[model samples]
Target chain A: MPTLPSLRASGGDGADPGRDEVASLTFESVTKRFDDVVAVDALDLEIHDGEFMVLLGPSGCGKTTALRMIAGLEEITEGRLYIGDRVVNDVDPARRDVSMVFQSYALYPHMTVRRNIESPLLVRKYRVDGDGAPPRKLTKAERAARVDEAARVLGLTELLDRKPAALSGGQRQRVALARAFVGRPQAYLMDEPLSNLDAKLRAATRLELVDLHRRVQTTVVYVTHDQVEAMTMADRIAIMSAGRLQQVGTPQEVYDRPANLFVAQFIGTPPMNTLTGTVTTDGGTGPAVDVGHGRVPLPPGLTTRLEEGRPVVVGVRPEHLALSDEGPLEQKVRAVEWLGHECLVFGAIGDSPLVVRQTGLARLEPGGTARLVVDPAHVHVFDPETTERLP
Target chain B: MTAEAVTSPAADRSPEVPRSRRRWLRRYSPREVLLALALLAPSIAVFVVFFYRPFLNLLNWGRFESRRNGAYFEDVGLAQYREALGSDDFREGLWHSVQFVLYTVPAGLVLGVLLAVAAHRRLRGIKVFQAIFSSTLASSTAVTSVIFFYLFNPVVGLIEANWLNDPDMAMVAVSISSIWQNMGLSFVIVLAGLQAVPDEVMEAALLDGYGAVRRLVRITLPLISPVLLFLLVVLVIFGLQAFAQIDIITKGGPVSATETLVFKINRLNRPDNIGIGAVYSIGLFLVTLVVTALQFAILERRVHYAR
Candidate 1:
């Protein structure tokens, strides 16, 4: 594929794509209800200008609904949405000046790629006073030029004459991207746009999207259930569960210091291993959590904040647990997965299942005993009753 | 050791025998063949009895002419076909049928699309509106024709119009009855097509800056073009073969102005004109064939079937 021309060179007036007019999005206590079910409940979030904000969660987490509400595809039942200081709750989707890429890549099947990219430009009702100006239509030549610029950026110039059905899945996705780009909207709302691509293609497209963002510098609100995409691309990740926002922070912040037990388990690939234990200061150590096997010491910083005798869940990431010669914890190995670079050892520690992400080859055999120790700083303790993380 | 050695030789020989026997047996299995024949019998019988036999008989009869009030027959061969097809009566009947098709086909298509698009939304009481639009399906053609006949009667009708007596308007009145009768079917078919379009496609269009009217014209219509074509073919066939509406409302009256091809064929069913009637039947069949072929050739090029 050929490299894209500089957006500045392509613009009629030598405008930089990075300096294009972008807007910040604000959701103020937005709620959407469907009869007896609340799809999104009192959500409050602010996306900065030119930021790539991703809503990450499992199915039915209201992530897609929130994105749709911003696009004005779904009505905001109880709160206000603003794009660039203008409250857009009552605005039509077209008038909101936001473009969207759907999960299905919803290309008009009957239209050629050129026509598909030109559709948004054709219907744009340009306003001067924001109220009563006559709509200014783009000329035929101008529309064609805009379509050509977008196609060149996405490497779709050769396929402009073909219909969507004639293109491959990945090509169709790029066409959808080109269509969204041609409109030059303030924000792009994408709903799991990469979910339909194959794994290898999805990874390649992920990098392309980050590069595109760097060049365009437009605000993007992307929704996906895949944490890998969220971790790699998002400037900030917002995690939602059961129609409520759980945590919103940088990827490292959310991973290293989860707001609750759900975020800890939901954000990682091998998922954090959790064991139920009771906080005990009676041990010789200052503060410790006693599982049935033994008592693990807690860091001094956390011990001062946690009360003794409180029932809590100890959360440890798989990579944090290491094999030691004589460690406090012992488990009988049940399974070993030997990936090329690393191995995953699954075993039971005192009736609680634990997974260890060991670097290099694993030597433990099934049914054999292995000693393990956890990094004290990486340990996370959650209040079992409320399921919230301890300071 | 002796038993194993003996069985090994026998097993090697047995494989060859069964392989060849199985191939031969599979080629003409009696039970499977009988089952396949049984499943296809009903459809084959219907095709032969209703379609093939009638068409062949009409072709054969077109070569003969009835004489002496049906007491005798003369085999005129291709001459009768040419003579009957060239007559002014046959041409007039065909012209009237074409006029009826013009009246009903476009009306049916436009009204079907309008009703389908209106009722496709998720508003409150939408089901009630759909039911009302589809209610005409319950009325038979003869029943609808009678109802319309009385409604447009010059003396006792609600509007008291002379539609059934005017030569210029008798076919128009009969066409009105046919269009009304076809609305329910057209609406249902078009609505099914509209429903098959995914909701995300419409949402994407809206985000791309399409208003309701533009979406219908550019997206909805093109997506449903195949369904509309199917409806067009059906309406053309119905309009050409329409009998009951003309029979009840005009009876080919007002100086034979509204006598379609089918009405002429029905009138020729008398004992003396059976041969000419058969010739007209063949001509109507050819006309329908040509029209349906032209429709597919022209419309299929524009249809975009979603992958």
Candidate 2:
């Protein structure tokens, strides 16, 4: 069971997650509406101490809005936010003690990297010295130490003197990271941090970010549209759609048992195939679904409740489809992508196309006929109207 | 490389270059340049005939000073230049102009930045405020001077300030009027610069825990440096050419306290010192040239354009 309680026993969950003293961040039914468009609608999320949580969604799905709300950059239309036990809804972003890494890596264009990273610390608070009418400015040595410490944290020591325009994209990202980490805030809010990098660079930065998270051990709320990024980096992913949370679970749980059709379709590559079918009783075993031209047996004990011909959607991942010389359902191969070690054959049966992943270097042509056998145990039935998974 | 190499050979393509270039130039024609040349040609021709030609003639004319009724006509080569350069009046006018610049430029820059920053936000009815702030652009220098003249009138003035009448404050009064007229231009320039900053940059700064003041000081100011430099250069030039404000309001009176270089040059229009006026005009031109060049040299290095 990948439940919160078990996670706590492993030192993965913080005690009293809603309490600001225990959790690094908490959103108590936060809602943000912009010009009648509800960007974030009654969202309740908590990031415990030392956890990496990714907010995953497609565009216009409110993930960015949720992250901004946590950063105190966006006004929370309703609900309260807490950082380490303090209600930060009315607090300005500067007082929130949370830092954000922007998608554009908006480095201050005028300042060198050192000055940029040092700006937050320098402006954090003002102090008056003994009998001094005015506040004392930071000493050169203090500023230098802070800059060096922050730069070392983000591996940006060599590039501190350079202007942002002079640095490459990856270096600019590091500078952005350095800027965020300089203050040593309680949490980090990263909005699509690696979306701008090339594929290889994205992979490399992903690993670096995980390692950095391990080293820093600070709570993080990462927002990304890429599910792979969400899955690879997040301890738990909160998937959103249409300004509503669709599902929240570990990578494998969401993959194996998605809450709805959107999550099922969104989390996988070459997505799960959904075929319209009718649920029929096959002698006391759970309601068997009669897919067109063949029947897929269901799990035990659902036969009596469901009617013989209730419309449903059968979802089976491509890898779960086994190929055979003489299977129940036949398909005509539409295309064949032959990797060196394995092959993926895409085919159409009746009116629906099926994707089958098979191991080995078997050559299948576009016109060839093949059999696709669905595993009864792996097959899932979803309610067509509600789009929720049914037993 | 493959895509380009597949195209027809350069010999065939090169022949069409001039034709397409000419067509492009024709379609997006430089109307401003043509209009500028058209309008300036007649003025430039008139200036050459009436101003430059007579000035050159006067430089020569000074060598042979003509006097009627028993006065001798003497030829003194470069003597008038030496005397004008050495004169206390020329030095006085130079100091007055420098003082005028000191009073006007800084005030204009500060007022412009303040108004621009205030009106740049998305406040309610802000557009109306911006329109009112820049409304001074509608008034000419002479009109502005006349408006301020009555406003600062000692007895019947709206402000009830005697500073305009006092020699100690005459330059400051005239600078106030000039600032009033020029503030609008400054506001417009700075506001445009402020508005041109991308919102993402500001949001990013906010997310990085920068307060409003830090963001403005560190990000907004630097991004708008080019505009500030432009406003500075224009205001300095306007400061140097402070004529109508002085002419209509002070008339170079109150013990010549408000007499700028242009006013001094205009004063040289008197029959006896025509040659000296040309010297002042030439001197003003040199000062403007040097000031503009120095401003550009010093400020250009500081402004960072998004490359």
Superposition TM-score, candidate 2 onto the true structure: 0.81
Q: CA shift at B148, candidate 1, in angstroms?
A: 2.1
State how far residue A348 of model 2 sits from its true place (Å): 4.5
In order, what fnat does every candidate score?
0.50, 0.39
Cα deviation of A127, candidate 1, in Å: 8.2
Residue pairs with backbone atoms closer than 3 Å in model 1 (clashes): none
Model 2: DockQ score: 0.21
On lDDT, the leading prediction is 1
True contacts kept of 2: 0.39
Query: In order, what lDDT does every prediction score?
Result: 0.86, 0.78
The positional error of residue A352 in candidate 2, measured at the CA in angstroms, is: 4.7
Residue range A1-391, candidate 1, lDDT tens digits: 3344543212334433345443899999999998789999999999998899999999999999999999998898999999989999999999987889999999999999999999988978543222344656678997899899888777778789999977778888888988888877788999999998888778878877887876777889999999999999999999999999999999999999899999999999799988889888784546779877866667546743767777889988999989997788887899999999999999987888999999999899999988888788888888898899888
